[model samples]
Target: MGIRVGTRDDAEAIAEVHIASWRVGYAHVLPESVLYADDFEPRRRAIWSEWRFAPTQRVAVSVDDTDRVVGFAAYGPERERARGTTGRGELYAFYFHPDVWGNGAAAGLIDHVGERLRAEGFDEAVLWVLDDNPRARAFYERHGWHPTGIAADFDVHCELSVPEVEYHSPLTVEGRP
Candidate 1:
């Protein structure tokens, strides 16, 4: 697997990963009607098409041997409302195609994103995950991200919402031995 910066041209592939991952990952936690909606792909594609990465924002994609995007991570300066100090970064979105779940692509993306965040001078970072998603929570725990106990209800759609918890990680300073 390889990791690199994502571009506008990758919007479709990124959307594919987003939908596939959500379909499998959130099957139990989220409503099937919303996940299987026909407009889901188009909506995601539209979002990716218009996404503008801020100067401090970084988007990374993990590709297979064929150079096809298999996973992606979008992060940037921590947004307001998250419980964190200054100089913090936020992992806005992360997803991988279900087919590549156990192939270490996810690990590579997390490490790459952490390095990018540290290089940007962020001392720490936070990400929101579904409170009931054991697989994702465990993955973050194994990756050194601990829950901050900050919980919120994430609106998945009109009249559909779920609980989420924030996970925090302190990015090692660059040049540290």
Candidate 2:
């Protein structure tokens, strides 16, 4: 697999990975209705189509031998700013095709993301994972992320929410994780 900066042309492929990963990875944590929603793919495509990268915001994707995106990671300046912390970034989203799990594509994307965030002058980075999604949480942990004891309910739709815990890692060390 190869890693590269995502472009507008990759919107559809990224959406495919996003939807597929959510469907399989969150199958147990989220309701089937939400995961398999009829409008999910279209909505994802639309969202990705509107994605734009900036100085502190960017996305990287992992592609297979055929150059099809199989995983992606989106990151930028932390959305939920914390007092006294200006060098913190946030891993807004991370997803990979279920079939690519355990193949190290996710690891490659994450490493590239970390290097970019560090080069951008971010000292640390944060990400939220569903509290019940042990598989994902473990993956983050294995990559040097640790829970920050910060928990919140992420509301997806009307009256539907899921608990998520924050994880953080220092980006000061080059080639770390």
The TM-scores, one per candidate, come to 0.93, 0.92
Residue pairs whose backbone atoms clash in candidate 2: none
lDDT by residue for model 2 over 1-177, one digit each (tens)?
999998878888888888898889888888888877787777788878875355556889999999989999889888854334555888989999999899888888888888988887788889888999988999999989999998889876557899998899998576443
Cα lDDT listed for each candidate: 0.85, 0.83
| Tens-digit lDDT string for candidate 1 (1-177) | 899999888888998899899989999988888997887777888878776455666789999999999999999888766454556888889899999888778987898888888888777888999999999889889888999889989989778999999888988653110
Off by over 4 Å in 1: 52-55, 82-86, 173-177
List candidate 2 segments past 4 Å from native.
52-56, 81-86
TM-score computed on alpha carbons, candidate 2: 0.92
- Judge candidate 1 against the unseen true structure and give its global Cα lDDT, from 0 to 1: 0.85
